[model samples]
Target chain A: MTDATLTRPAFRRGVPPQLIGLGALVAFFLTVELLIQIGVINRFIVPPPSDVIGSFGRVIVEEDVFGRFLLTLSECLIAGVLLTVVGVGGGVLMHRYRLLQQACETWVAAMASAPIVLMYPLFLVIFGRSMWTMIMMGFVAALPPVILKTLEGLSGTRKVLVNVGRSFNLTPSQQFWKILFPAALPTIFVGIRLGLIFALINIVGVEFLINFGGLGQLINELAERYDLPGTYAAICFVILVSILFFMTLEKIERWLRPFD
Target chain B: MLTPANPTTQAAADDAILVVDNIVVRFETPEGPIVAVDDVSLKVKPGEFLSVIGPSGCGKSTLFNVVGGLLSDHQGTVNVAGETISGPHQSIGMVFQEESTFPWRTVTDNVAFPLELTGMPKAQRIERARHFIALVGLDGFENRYPGELSGGMRQRVSLARTLASEPKILLMDEPFAALDEQTRLLLGDKVLQIQQALKQTTLLITHNITEAVQMSDRIVVMTYRPGKVKRIVDIDLPRPRTSEIVGSEAFGRYVAQIWADLREEASRGMRDEEKHTLEHHKGGAS
Candidate 1:
């Protein structure tokens, strides 16, 4: 079935997918580093990989990199928790109530395409220039996909499974928890992954735009000072933060739905 | 020629574990109300393997659904073990034509699910589930997910789950239709063995006349649209038989008789489908 292919990551020919992805990333960094050393690409605009690596310790000690990373991680964590709870909850409610689904499905789906980051000024006014602004921003940005995907997931559960429940005389609550929820989990995880990634991106973007918190803010300050190596170093940490978040999220997803 | 309804239907109901009486289902579409099942009735005696065979779109599934309590807007009274059922009943269990095993669950967990709902203790349910699993010849693959198994194996898992419930009457709707001919025959043999061992009353819905002949004590042939019982042919095959019986003379005669009965109805169904597409095309052209 198409679902079999969609749920499991393809690992063809005895090779793991992660190793291929890692190899590509390393090759990309090496190519850029080589181009810079050969004077094919300017070092001022984009620092060489070796220079960025060399300055990592200095950036960590002088600029408190770990603190910046922690701040971003906390913001992501808070936003992640809010989106998962509200997003999945909203999807279930909307699915249960047809009127709610009809009224909001299009609006919510359209929200996914909207430039939510542009409205950071409004968030600042409402939530103020504190961490709430970034946290709220991430939550809002991530919410749509989670809700939509959850709806998709729940609705996509095969009719046969539902009938199996009904034939066996499952109560409404038991049917939902036992059949509908687990059947919808793979698609829901797709939503969670998208929502978490969106949350992380917007949180960092708000940090950079407002110049107030996290890796985004540190990168902003470093760029302003023309500390190119340190800025690249900080940008690297942003990538690191996202990869870390995704790896952790993936582990959680596996724990929640091991079959996928 | 229309053969009368099962001559034994009235006589057998007293001893029957399951009785589907006068089931008539009408589905309303833009075209208007279309009768799916029309006054069809059946009685499955305990330990009997009965099959309802018909052409595609002949409403065998609709009748199956009505009997299983999955379809409510139907004219029918389904009684299981002397209790009339207006909805899903504890004494009735259904296996479906589609892939129904929960993908997230292991084979053992899937089989143990119904017991879990009843608040049965974990160890007991797991042990009971293991017995059914072994009966279906899936002893070592208990922990594997449905996605990891082949189509035939997954059907076996679902069968094990349903059998674990020990329902008074089991309803199976085209359970092996998706498998290859060889797998279908082998699984059919396996099911026959298990059913006889447990004396499980089973009602299978299918279009395969050979399957009906091979697996059933009696076969009910249904007409096309507005499906009704067209005929009932008794197999009279000896007990403790396998699907290998298909090679025998009696099996061939039974298959031939059912095929002859279903041929006209199948043609009628195909003609209606063709006419439907023609009307749709003409309307779109206009």
Candidate 2:
């Protein structure tokens, strides 16, 4: 009963929240553009919306923005998939084994709290400051939340459900896959979404700091050369990528729990 | 009444499906070992509907855990379906409170789960799950996730899942406690209908006296903490218990009988808890 109500998102498809969120986003951007055009803000430094749009277009046509976007996307995807695998796998192991949960608790906490950007240099030393380093950094940052979420999620699974699994003479594996996992899904996805966002941010942040080959790296390169418009364009691209990632994840969350 | 022989030999018997010997359960605390269940014994005859009723912490659940092979430290043995239950046995199916129906699984998948473990092919599992789902009156909602259904509906799914396993014995732990009263009655009757059709041996643990009386052929009233069998009342009510039975004088008599036995145990349990608390406080002050 506690679990049945939890699997669905708080807001439904036709709710006012979605409408309000979209309306606010459009209004906020329009107000900013209007302020820039009316000279309330300095165009020289911040640049107007039109100029930003033009630069974005130029970057798309000349600099192969889609290819670079795909590159960044692929890295995030690889890191996300890897984080899920390692995180869920480790989580289940830890959950099933009480000693492991206790042993990994402090380690997971330390990894979760440590500055992922700082690890970029260490990864760079080891992996030579390539995309692999960025991915690893993302994984390190993302992994703790994923693992923690998995533990919390699995533990949060209703005692009622576990008893049910037991009643059916379910094996440990069967119980986990059928009962525990499903019961803990909403919380698991919360961890996954948090992990995805963390991984994306960390990957780009690492790329920016280490000057690797993603949009973040491009933004850093453009800024150093004082190509302000190009930097602006790359920043826009990053924003778009973040939005796209969020939307895709939201869609996936919906698909996984459709009726909800 | 059938009596199982030696625990090991009991399982190999042809008639009795489950035998729960005197099980003693205790929890180790900093203060001392807290006794939860003390010398509880029961047996499930083939196709018998047995309901155990007691107040909270009466160790009814602990008794179920012993039978389910969950608590090994307990002093007892459980034999299921011609096999000694060393651990969870595939021949015995279990249903828990509504939450056990995995929210992520559609009704079909949830029902098919036990079969999946048994290495049944996908098609056969699906077909079997569908049959069970229909048996539980959840035909159209097979594709719906547990999250999409009501509490009663979800419990039905859990029931379907348990039945889908085709286990010789089915164990339910307060499965209807979370539902509204109306839903509980409906589900209870639905469960009774299924049990009648399948002729499955069932053991249900509940706090609801009326539910125990309405559904069970025999009701085992349990004592409070350090639980023991207080009494066993046989329901003389005829089979295929309908909603109309709830209004019958026979049902009222059963409810009153269970309540009388339970009240004394509940009072005793409360006093035990209070005394323990006071002792803890005095020790702290010293």
Candidate 3:
């Protein structure tokens, strides 16, 4: 019985949606390239797909885009980590204290829809147009969703599970650790993913606006220099970075919740 | 003010493992304060298997919850082994109707959770959990999470987890209601065997008459909304009961008797539901 129950099927699992999506993306690019080659579409405005693909090597070598890529990656990493810590911590605090939740919940929701990016000038004055300014902007823009998701997850734990904990005479802290936290984990991770997305947008946008550092700055430079294909290649690299972030988040979520 | 048939009931039984005395639970809803359990009382003898069978919304579950310490703000006291319970007591374990097995944890870990709360050593807790897991016949699937298991298997895991706590009294709130009839009966047999072996006092809240007759030493029948204990019927059937025993003539008689008692209350509940639906539709039309 033990062996039969424990052994999963030997065959590999079904194909992932990401693989299918990649297939569709390649097909789309091929169609666009064909249209441009046949002169059915103007190449000046939307560069030929082949030219953009060919410019990847030049973007890496001549443009030295890797350093700028590293800069944007670092900003995103710092912002992402801070957003997670502050958002999850604040969420737990609000959930634990009713008064705090009631007072700040509305503000948090409003902040989520607020035009936080428009306050970049204010942040610039406070932090002096440095990477800190960009990081802080990203952090503020990304925080609300994480806090709200964590609150929802922790509060939404099933009453039956909590009752089970109570019946066993678990202390509040013990109940949180054993029952509430683990159950809330999937939702909390969802918040983190959403926060990372907002952080990535603000980080790249700020870099472009300030003409400071990272892939966003490179894209701005390439566009201004009429290096259209190079601009597209750099933009593609930014998309790759987003994909990597999401893929890593997905792997982490799976590792943390293998059963789910 | 419907009085329980066994009104000569002892408030404090010397051999009683659990005594619920005149528990009245009321909830303040938008409509007003609704009485759920109205002055209901009962006692379970040590190692006795007792079932509370009732019509829908009859407060059998409310009574069960009060006993389980999941609900407070009630009017009366619940004593377990002569001690009053103001809050959740470690000696009392509850199994819920809904699937309550911790999905994030493996079967072994879920069983070992209560043990872990008491700060038991890791190896010893696992060893103890393994005993109950095997008792429920889930030895090999110890490492599998609850999500990977079937509904019946998950409920078995819940049963194992509750039993592993070794509570003096187990309160089961329609724990097998979600399963099919066949699985319910099979699990009922497993429960009877476990209760016989362990001799733990059990209070089961169920709507199934057959289950009440097959597993319980005594059955407490309850009325509809604002629930009151309608009767307490003793099961004179032979013990060492199993699913096979449910087919016996005596078992059928006990089930028939309880069904007869419940038929009126069930009809009333259904009528009330229909009236409410009609009223809601009228309100919508207006």
* Candidate 2: residue A1 Cα off by (Å): 36
Best by TM-score: 3
* Cα displacement (Å) at residue B10, model 2: 19
lDDT of 3 at A101: 100
Better of 1 and 3 by TM-score: 3
Model 1, B134-217: lDDT tens digits are 999999999999999999999999999998888988889999999999899999899899988999888999988877777888
lDDT of 1 by residue, A84-147 (tens): 8999999999999999999999999999999999999999999999999999999999999999
Tens-place lDDT per residue, model 3, A218-245, is 9889989989999999998888878888
Q: How much DockQ does model 2 earn?
A: 0.47
Candidate 3 accuracy as TM-score: 0.95
Q: Relative to the unseen true structure, what is the C-alpha lDDT of residue A171 in candidate 3, on a scale of 0 to 100?
A: 77
Locate the minimum summed-lDDT window of 10 residues in model 3 chain A.
A5-14
- Best of the candidates, DockQ: 3
| lDDT, model 3, position A106 | 100
lDDT of 3 by residue, B104-203 (tens): 9999999998888778999999999999999998989999999999998999999999998899998999999999999999999999999999997899
* lDDT of candidate 2 at residue B220, scale 0 to 100: 82
TM-score of chain B of each: 0.96, 0.90, 0.96
- Please say which candidate is ahead in TM-score: 1 or 2: 1
lDDT tens digits by residue: candidate 2, A1-260? 57766676645434688787998887887888899889998776776666766787778887777887888888898999999899988888899999999987889979888886776778889888678988888888999888998999999877766766665566678778777886677787788888988888888888888777788888888788776778888888888877887898889878877766
